[model samples]
Structure formats: structure tokens, C-alpha cells
Target: MIIPAIDLIKGEVVRLHQGKFNLKRKYLYEPLFYIQKCLKEGAKKIHIVDLDGAKNPNKKQINLLKEISKYQIPSIQIGGGIRSQKDIDLIFDLIPNAQIILGSSIIKDFKNVQKWFNLYNPHSIILALDIKFNKNYEKIIFINGWQNKSNMIFEDIIEKFLNIGLKYVLCTDISRDGTFLGPNINLYTEIVKKYPEIFFQASGGISTLQDILNLKNSGVKNIIIGRAFLEKKFTIKEANLCWQKE
Candidate 1:
């Protein structure tokens, strides 16, 4: 699946390079424009990130999210700044069947999140592991919009949670994110091979159709394309065609 991204920064459409807020390009359009564009051109799933909300959990992008959910076009997955059931309720109030992505909460209180976050269908809740490969050559999970790094390893965290009903996860290579170079194919290959049961979505650094094919051939069933799509490297129609070929 090619999940198009519509990142909201200050309630406007924007994309950040390498997850750096200081380095970003804001597009001239309301969030709904892009959300509808993706749906109009053939997008099965859309990923929306709340930049401001991620930084300040108290400030919810409720208005923006509510507008996007009103379309009811396809699966709408939202993340960033969502940390509690209260936030989830506010989101569901807008779109009852929406999917929620859990970020720092996985690191802040893994056990509590795992146990308390059992109110929905396992597939609707996803763990977004925003990770960075540290200089020590270990993949460490980053939280708070990639501002804080943790000592916990990515594999260990997943292994620990898989038993507690972690059915879905999206992994983003922070260094390659928004660069449009390509994804860390080897990393995803190892992950898919190790835990074939978990539904993993490979995100970040996807620029071309070959990159999509490579990841698909490597056993990655879902791919998240952000900058590449926004930059018009390929249209949603073309990606949807490719997915049909699969």
C-alpha cells in the first residue's frame, strides 16, 4: 500500500526534512486539499501528522483532523501529539473508524500503554517507531517528534510488545526521512524476515517506483511515501497502478 502523507504544521500543509522542524517547506493550501487530492487520485490510506500537537500534547489538532475525517474516503491514520484515551476519544468523536498511531507513549510507559490501549481493534492502533541509527550502530527509538533519543533498542521493544498484542507498526529511518533518496531496504528486510507475523509498514526516503518494487520484493507489504508524492516524483494514479500489478 502506498500511504500518502499530509503533515500539518501550524494548521497548514508542510513537510520537514529529516524530522527537523527548523528545516521544512510549507505548502500553500488547507490540509483538506491534499487529503482530497490523495483520495481523488487513488489512495487507499493517508497518513497525517500534527507537528504542533506532537510538540505540545495539550494542543490537539482537533479541527484539522475533524475536517479530514469528514471526507470518509479511505483509511485515515493520525499520529503526533496523541498520548491518552481522552485524545483518542476526541479523535473518534470526529471519525469513529479512524486509526491512531502511538509514539512516545510506547517509551514513556510501555506497560501502561500496552495494557491501557486495549480499547480498540488491534489493527486500528499502530506503534510509530521513529528511530535513528546511533553512532554505536544500534537502532535507538526517538520520541517527542524525534527530539529525544532513548537507550532502548528497536528490536527489543518490538519483541517485548509483540506478546502483548502489538499487531501493527510503522518504522521510519529518521536520517533518511523526507530526503527522497530511498528507504533503508536492508533494515526493513531484516525486520520483515524476523517477525513475519507483525504487519510492518516501511516509511521514509521513498523516491521512485523501483524503491517501491525493491521493498515489496523484500517482503514489505506496505510502503509510506511522503516527499516523493508531494514533490510529484510520481502520481497517486501511477502508484495505485503499481499496487494493482502486485
Candidate 2:
């Protein structure tokens, strides 16, 4: 699946280079315009992240989300700063069909996250594992808008979640995010082969059709494309065709 991504800061569409706020790039279009365009281009799912919320849980883009919900888009995955039951409830109320993406909260409050999985359908929540490689070449998870690092291991985190009936995961390589270089193929390929039961959504640095094909060949069933689509590397229809091609 070619899921288009829209990152919002102050209700404006933007992209951050390698997860750094200092290297942000704002786009010209509004969130609704981008959503409508993606839908028109055959995108069945859209990934939205609230940068403000991720940086500070208190500052979630509620008004913007409310406006977006008016479209009644069913397959939107809303993430960033969703840390509690209240946040979850508010998002569901705004966009009833949205899948809540849990990032920092998953690490900070694993027990609550477990409860959420039991409360809501496992598929309704996506565990976002934004990771970076250390000097020792270890994959470490980063949280709190990628500003802080957690000592959690990649496989260890997934193993814990899998026991709780985790069905969806969106993993991004922070080093490659917004870089337009390419995805972490080696990392994704290894993880996909190891955990074939979970639906893994590969994100970050997907800039070309070949990148999509490479991931597909490596057993990745879904990918999140942001800058690639925005920069016109390829259209949604073209990416879908590539993914659907035999």
C-alpha cells in the first residue's frame, strides 16, 4: 500500500530533515487540499502527524484535526502527542475511523498501551518505532518528537507488543526520514523476514519507485511516502501500479 503522509506544524504541511525541527520544510498546500489530492490520486490511507503535539502533548492540533474529520475519511492514521485515554477519546470523537498511532507513550507507559490494545481493536492502534543507529550499530528507539533517545532494543519492543496482539507497526529510520535518500532496506528486510505475522509499514526516505519495488521484494507490504509524492518523484497512481504489478 502507498500511504501518503502529511506532517503538520501549526496547521501547516511540513517536513523535517532527519527528524530535526531545525531543518523543517513547509509546503504550500493546506492539509485538506493535500488529503483531497491524495484521495483523488487513489490513496486509500493517509498518515498525519501533529509536530506540535509530538513536541508537547498539550499542544495537539485539535482544531485542524476537527476540520479534517469533516471529510469523514475512514482510513486516516493520526499520530503524535496522543499519550492518554483522553487524547485517544478526543481523536476518535473527531475522526471516528482513525487509527491512533502511539509513539513516545508506548515506551513511557507500556502498561497503559497494553490496556489500550485490550480496550480497542489491536488493528485500531499502530505502534510507531522511530529508530536511529548508534555508533555500535545498534538500533535504538527515539521518542518525544525524536528529540530524546530510549535504550529500548528494536526486537525486544516488538516482542513485548506481539504478546498483546499487536497487528500494525510503522517503523521509520530517523536518519533517513525527510532525506529523500532511500529507506532502510536492510533493516526492514530483516525485520519482515523475522516477523512475518505483523503488518509492517516502512517509512522515511522513500524517494523513488525503485525504492518501493525494493521494499516490496524484501517482503514489505506497505510503505509511507511523503516528500517523494510531494516533490513529484511519482504520482500515487504510479506508485500503486508499481506495488500492484506482478
Candidate 3:
């Protein structure tokens, strides 16, 4: 599935390079316009991240999210600064069909996150692990909007959650995010092979139809596209063709 991603900053659509706020590029259209375009082009699911909320949990763009919830067509997956039960309740209240994405909170409060898995359908909660490689080529998880690094290893954390009913994981290569360099194919391929039960959503650096095809060929079922779609690198329809082709 080619999931069109829209990162929001105070209700405007924007893309941040390598997860850096200062290096973001704002688009001309608002969130709804892009959502409409993606739907028109046959996107079944849409990924939305609240940058404002990611930076400060209290600063979530509630009005914008409310506007998005009005369109009850696409399966919406929303993330960023969604740390507690209150946040989860608010999102479900506004967009009942939305899949809540949990990031930093999962790492900081692993035990509490387990309660969420028991409370909500496992499929409705996506665990987002943003990663960066170390000098020795170790995949380390970065949290807090990619500004801070944690001591957690990518595979180890996933291993811990798998037994606890983690169904979906959105892993982003922070180094490749918004860079348009290319995806971390080797990493995703290895992870998919290691854990075939989990539905993995590959994000970051997907700039071309070939990238989508490569990810699909690598056994990655879901791909999150941000800058590529916003910059017109390829249309959702074209990417879907590449993904759906046998």
C-alpha cells in the first residue's frame, strides 16, 4: 500500500529534511487539498503527522485534525506527540477510524504502551520507530521528533513488542527522511525477513516509482510517501501501479 504522508506544522503542509524543523519546506496547499488529491488518485490510506504536536504535546493542531476527520473515506493514520490515554481518546473522538501512531512514548514508557495494545485493537495502533545508523553501522532508535537518541536498538525493541500484540510498525530512516536519496532497502528487507508476521510500513527517502517497486519487491507491504508526492516526483496512481504490479 502506498500511503501518502502529510506532515503538518500549524495547519499548513510541510516537509522536514532529516527531521529537522529549521530545514522544512512548506507547500502551497493546505492539508485538505492534498488529502482530496490523494483520494482522487485512489489512495486508500493517508498518514498525517502533527509537527507542532511532535515538538510540544500541548500544541497539537486540533482544528486541522477535526477538518480532516470530516472526510470519512480514507483510512487515516495519525501520529506525533500522541503520548497518553488523553491524546488517544481525543483522536478517537475526532476521527474514530484513525489508527493512532505511538512513537517516543512507547520507548519512554514501554509498560504503559502495553496497556494500550490490550485496550485498542492491535491493528489500530502503529508503533513508529525513527532510526539513525551509528558509526559501527548499528541501527539506533531516535525519539522526541528525532532530536534525541535513545540507547535502544531497533530489532531489540521490536522483539520486545511483538509478544505484546504489536501489529503495525512504521520505521523511518531518519538519515533518509525527506532527503530523496533512496530508502534503506537492506534494512527493511532484513527486518521483514526476520519478522514476517508484523505489517511493516517503510518510510523515508522514497522519491520514485522504482523506489516503491524496490520496497515492494523487498517484501515491504506498506510505503509512506511524503516529499515525492508533494514535489510531484510521482503520482499516487503511478506508485500504486508499481506496488500493485506482480
Query: Candidate 3 at 169: error in angstroms?
Result: 0.6
Instruction: Please give, for residues 56-161, the per-residue lDDT of candidate 3 as tens digits.
Output: 8889888888888889656989998998999999999988888999998988988889999999888899999899999988889998888889999988889888
What would the C-alpha RMSD of candidate 1 be, to one decimal place?
A: 1.3
Report the poorest 10 consecutive residues by lDDT, candidate 3. 65-74
lDDT of each: 0.84, 0.92, 0.91
Q: Per-residue lDDT tens digits of candidate 1, residues 1-246?
A: 888988887788888889999999988778888878898998988888898888778876777777777687668888988888788778777877778888988888776677655666677788999889878878899988888888789998888888767888899999899898788999899988999998889988989988888888778778888888888999988987886676
Query: RMSD of candidate 3 to the true fold?
Result: 0.9
Top model number, lDDT: 2
Q: Please tell me which model should have the higher lDDT, number 1 or number 3.
A: 3
Clashes of each: 0, 0, 0
Q: What lDDT would candidate 3 get against the real structure? A: 0.91
Model 2: residues with Cα > 4 Å off, grouped in runs: none
The RMSD of every model to the true structure, in order and in angstroms, is 1.3, 0.9, 0.9
Give the clash count for model 1: 0
Per-prediction TM-score to the true structure, in the order listed: 0.96, 0.98, 0.98
Residue clash pairs of candidate 2: none
